[model samples]
Target chain A: MRIRKLIPGVDANLLIKDAGKLMQDPMRRSFLRGAASLGALAFLTGCDIIDGDAAEGVLRKISELIDGAQAALVSRTKLAPTLKESDITRPFPFNAYYTEDEAPAVDPATYRLEVSGLVDNKKPWTLDELHALPEVSQITRHVCVEGWSAIGSWQGAQLSEFLKRIGADTRAKYIWFKCAEGYTNTIDMPTALHPQTQMTFKFDNKILPRAYGFPMKIRMPTKLGYKNPKYVVAMEVTNTDHGGYWENQGYNWFGGL
Target chain B: MTAETMTASQDAPIHPGWVRICHWINALAILVMIGSGWQIFNASPLFDFTFPRSIALGQWLGGAIQWHFAAMWVLVINGAVYVTLGIVTGRFRRKLLPIYPRDVVADAKAALTFKLAHDDLAHYNAVQKLLYAGVIIVAVIVVLSGLAIWKPVQFQELTALFGGYDFARYVHFAAMAAIVSFLVVHVALALIVPKSIRAMIAGR
Candidate 1:
C-alpha cells in the first residue's frame, strides 16, 4: 500500500471500481489468464509475418539497399586514418579464401595488367610500367568483415591518377577487378577515385610479396579487406556490376569499411 | 446498452493502437537482431566464450550479416516512431516520468518482499520507469556502436568516441547484453503479472 502510493499511474478510484469484478467469474478469468502466452505465440506466428525464401529475398533486398547507403555515406575528404610506420602491424596478416601458400604465384617480369571497357587506353600494363607510374605510401587499417583489423604500410600509385593516365571514363559506374587467383570484385567509381585508393605494387618499400597479393593489388582503405583484391591481373571500367566473389554468396556488395 | 456503456467507460485501454503495433514490431525486430548478432559474434568472438548455434540465428557469418543488416532498418524506424509517438502523446511523461529514486528503493524493497501492489496494470512503479527508459537508451547505444563498427573509417570520430574500431565491438556487445538483460527481466515480470500481457495485447 505504501509503495502503491508512489506509483505514477495508480488510481484508487479505478482500483476500487475494478475490485468487484475480480472474483465474479473465476473459471472464465482463469482461462483468459492462461491465454496470454498462447495469444503471444499466435501473434508471432501470424500470417502477416514473412518466412522461408520470401524472408531471404527481403533480407537480400535490404542488404542490397545498404550498398546505396554506404555509397552515400562515403566522402572523399574524409580519409581512413593514416598511421605512422611504427603503427603497422608486424608481419601484416595474410588473408584470403584460400591458404596463404596457395596465393597466386605470378612471374613479376612476365605479368601484364589488362585494362579494358570504358578506357581510351585498352593497353595492358606491365609491372615495370606500373612501377614507372608515380608512387605514394600510405599506412592505414585494413578492417575485415569478420571483425579483425590490422594496420599496414602500403606503397602504390594513386588509382585515381592511373585512371586519368589510362583515360578511363570517369562517368563509369564501377571499376571491376579480376585477380590471378580468380578472386573478383567491383567497387564504385567514387571509391575508385578516392585519393587513398591505390593500385599497389609495393609493400613496406619492397616489391609486393606473393603473400601480399604479389604482382599488384588495388588497395581501397575505405573498404573491407575482401574488397581489396590482390594479385590483380585485369581491371575494367564499366556500368555493369559483374557480381563479386563473396558478394554473390550473401555478403554486402559495398563492404564499405 | 447501459451495461456496455458502463464497461466501456470504466475499462479504458492503457496502450493506444500505435503503441501496441510498435510494441509487437519492436519485439520481432529485437529478436531477429539479437539472434543474428549472436551468430556474427561467434565468427570472431570478442570473449573466450561463444554463443551456441542453437540459440543464434543465421547458419553462418554471411547469412548472419544479411539478417543483421536487414532487421536494422525495421528496428531503427520502428523505435523512432515509438519514441516520437510516446513524446507527442505525452504518454512518456504521464506514464514514465517523475521517477523518484526514493520511490525506486521503496518499490524495489517491496518487490523483493513480494508486497508490491501492481494490481493497477496501467500505473508504473519507479523501477519499471527506470528500466523502460534505460532500455531505450541502451538500444540507441547499440545502434550507434554498430554504425561505428560498420563504417569505422567513414565514421571515424564516432568510432574514436567508443574507443576505436576494435573496442567498438565490445561496446556493441555490452549494449546488446544490457538489452538482453532488460528483456529477461521484462519478460519475467510480464509472466509474473500476466494481466500486463493482456493489457499490452488488447491495450486494456
Candidate 2:
C-alpha cells in the first residue's frame, strides 16, 4: 500500500521484533507512555489548536481578538445587569396573557384608560388626559426568547404618573395591564414602575399602527417582546401574581432581557 | 523462508505515521473545545423571562466561545491536512474504501456482538470506516453551522441552511453533542483494543 512507504513494512517477524523492542527499552516505553499521558491531558484541557490560537501567549488571552468580536462582546455584556444580577434564568419562551379577541379601536373622543385595581382613587382619563402629562422617549432593545432582537425608540407616559395619580396601595405587589383588545399581562410593581417601562404611544417617531396598538402600548425594554403588550386598555394594581399568554405557554413570565 | 513466513511478511501495518498524528491531534482539539464550549454557552443562559434552568448545567458562555472558536480553527486545518494527505497518498482507497456493504454489515454485526476481540486489525472493519466518514461529515456540519451563528448577518444563507439562527444554533449544539458521544465510543474501543493505540503511535 502507498502508506507502507511512509512507515516500515509490517511482517509477523517485524511485529514480534517491535514488541520486543518496546518491552526491552524501558526508557522509550516510558517516553511513549508520557506522550500518551500528554495526549489524554490535552483532551481534558481542550487543547489550544481547537481554540484557533496557536501562539502560546495568545492561548491564555481572555480578551476579544478582533474589533467586531470586541464590539459584540462588549455590547452584549453591557446591555443589562438584570441578566447577570437576576437569580433566575429560564430557557423557555415567554408567554404573556391576553384575551382571544382583537383590541377595540381607540375612540379618541370617549376613550379613556380606566386606572382601577388596588388604587385608592380609581378614575378614567382620556387620551389627551395621559398625553397631557410629561413624556419620555428612549431607544432600547427588545429581547425575545425566540433568540432575536430589535432596537427602537419608544415614547409614552411614565408609568410612575399613573401610579402616583391613582395613589397605588403600598401593599400592591403586581401591576395588571389590561389592553384595549382585552389582552392582560401582569408584572411585579417594581418592574412595572421601572424607569424604562412606559405606556408608549409612539414608536420610531410614528404613531404605532393598530396591530402595534395605535392609541397606546407598553414598553418594557428589560423584558421579552411578549411581556411588552400592545393596545393597553387599563391598568390594575393588584397584590396577587398573574401570568400573560406566552407565560402560560411554558415561556418564562419575567422575560427579562 | 517457508511459504507461511513469506505470507506473514506480506501483511502491511494498519496505521500510518501521518494518519496517526492527525487522529491524535484531532482528539486533543475536540477535548479542549468541549470543555471550553460548555463554559461559554452559559452566558445569559436562559430560555425566556419566567422559568429558570433549562437543563441542569453551568454558565461558561464566554469561556466556551473563546475556546470553541480557537479549537474550531485547529479542527478545520488538521482535518484539511488529513483529507489532503489521504487523497494524495491513496491511503484512503487502500484502507477506508473498497469496503463493500456486505462486508461492512458483517463486520458491524461482529463488532456489536463482541465476536471480534481486540488486536484484530485485519484492515479496519467496516464499522471503523463508517465512523471515520461520520466524524468527517459531522465535523464539516459543525464548522458551517458555527459560521452561520458566528456571523448571522454575513452568512445568511448558511444560517438558513440549518433553519434560522435560533434553529441553526440548536443544530450546532446538537452536532457538538453527537461528536462528543462518538469520541467517547472511539476512546472506549481504543482502550479495549490496546494494540490499536500502540499501532497508531508506533506506525505498526
Candidate 3:
C-alpha cells in the first residue's frame, strides 16, 4: 500500500515475519470458524461495505432514525426541572456565534412580532399586546451544545397560548422562527406546545437586555441552547420543515436534549 | 522449519472471535468519539483554553456533533455486546474474576518493583484484571454521564445523581480523562510486551 511508505523506520521483513506467524496461529483458525455466519448476517442486512457513498447514506439514515426515536420518546407534558431563585446563574453568559458587541439592536417602538403560515389570524403583535396576555415565569437551565449550562428566570406568555390567540393551525408539524439578527430556526409542533416553551419578553423580572435578545426570545428548556431562537421577529406555523440556522448545517433538527 | 511445524508451535487459543472483534471496534469508536468530542469542546472552550483544531476531527462544531452522535451508537452497541457475551460465555468468571486481594497486592508489588511476570502471556495477571474491570466501570460512568448531559430533562434523575447539569459535565469530562489515561498505560504495556499484541490480533 502507498500509505506504508509514510512510516519512517518499519522493517518490511519483520512485518512479513509477523504476518507469517499470525497466519500460523491455531487460534486464528478457530476465530475464522464464525466468519461464514458473519458474512451471511452481513448479506441478510443488505449492507454494501464496498460502496463509500452507500455507507455514508446508511449513516445518515441511522441519524434520522435516532432523531425520529428521540422525538417519539419525548413527553410533551413533562416540564424541565425548575431552579430556585438563588440557583440562577448570575450575569448569564452571553452566547452567540458573534461577540457581545455585535448583538443586533432592534427598536421596541417599531418591533412587531409577525405571524404567518398556517394561521387564520395573521395580525402582527406589538410588544404591549404580547405582554397583555396571561404571563408565566420559569427559572430553568439553558443547556448549551458546547457543554455548559446556566439557569435564569424568564417571564413570558405561553407559546401555546400565543398560538391559540393567533389562530395558528395546531396541527402543523413545525413552527419556524425568523430572528432580527438574521438567525432562522424551526422546532417540532409538540416542542412548541411544551409547557416550558415560552415566548419570553422579560429576563430576571426586567426587560430583556440586548445581549439576551430583547423584544422576544423563544425559551425552550427541553432543548439545547441552539434550538431556542433569540431576537425573534417572525413566526410561521407550517407542516413543512424549514430547518434551523445550525440545523441546516448538520445539527440535529430534533435537538431535544 | 516447515509451515506445519510453525503452525503446530504457534497454535495456542487466546482471544475468542467476539472479544477480538469487539475490542477493535471499540478502539476505533473511542478514537473517533474522543477526536470529535475535542472539536465539540472547542466551541465553548471549557476553562480558559481550547483544544487544538489540528489534532481534532470535524473542523466545524455541527460536523463534530454529527460524528460524536454517530460514533456514540457504535460505542454503546459494541460495548453492550462485549459485556453481555463476556457474561454469557463465562469469560468474565474464568478470565477476569478469581483475583484475590493477596494476588492483587503481590501483583502490584512485582509491577512497582519492575518485575513483571512474563511467563504466562496467555492469561491476564491480577493487576490486568483489576485495571480492565475498572475501565469497564469507567465506561459505564462515561455513558451514563453522557446521557445525563445529552437529555437532562428526560434523564432528570441521572442529572440529579451527578449533582446537576454542571456537575454532570464535570463527571463526563473526568471520565473521558480517565479513559485516555488508561489508553496511555495500555499502549505502553502493549509496546513492552509485543507478544501480547500479537496474541490479541492472531489469537494465539
The residue pairs found clashing in candidate 3 are: none
DockQ of each: 0.21, 0.02, 0.17
DockQ of 1: 0.21
lDDT of 1 at B136: 85
TM-score of chain B of each: 0.94, 0.80, 0.89
- The prediction achieving the highest TM-score against the true structure is 1
lDDT of 2 at A103: 34
Per-residue lDDT over A133-193 for candidate 2, one digit per residue giving the tens place of the 0 to 100 score = 7888767645444334444666887787768877998468788887765667887666666
Over the stretch B4-99, how does candidate 2's per-residue lDDT look in tens digits? 886775555567678889988887677756655543343332232221222211112222344455576788789899989988998777777875
The residue ranges of model 3 lying beyond 4 angstroms of the native Cα positions read: A1-62, B1-12, B112-114
Worst 10 residues of 2 chain A by lDDT: A1-10
CAPRI tier of model 2: incorrect
When sorted by DockQ, best at the front, the candidate numbers are 1, 3, 2
lDDT of 1 by residue, A18-130 (tens): 22333244421222122112223245453423343554566678888887776676774568989898888886777665556667899977899999999999988888899
Q: Return the interface RMSD of model 1.
A: 15.8
lDDT of 2 at B161: 82
Q: Judged by lDDT against the true structure, how good is candidate 3?
A: 0.79
Model 1 chain A, TM-score vs. native: 0.80
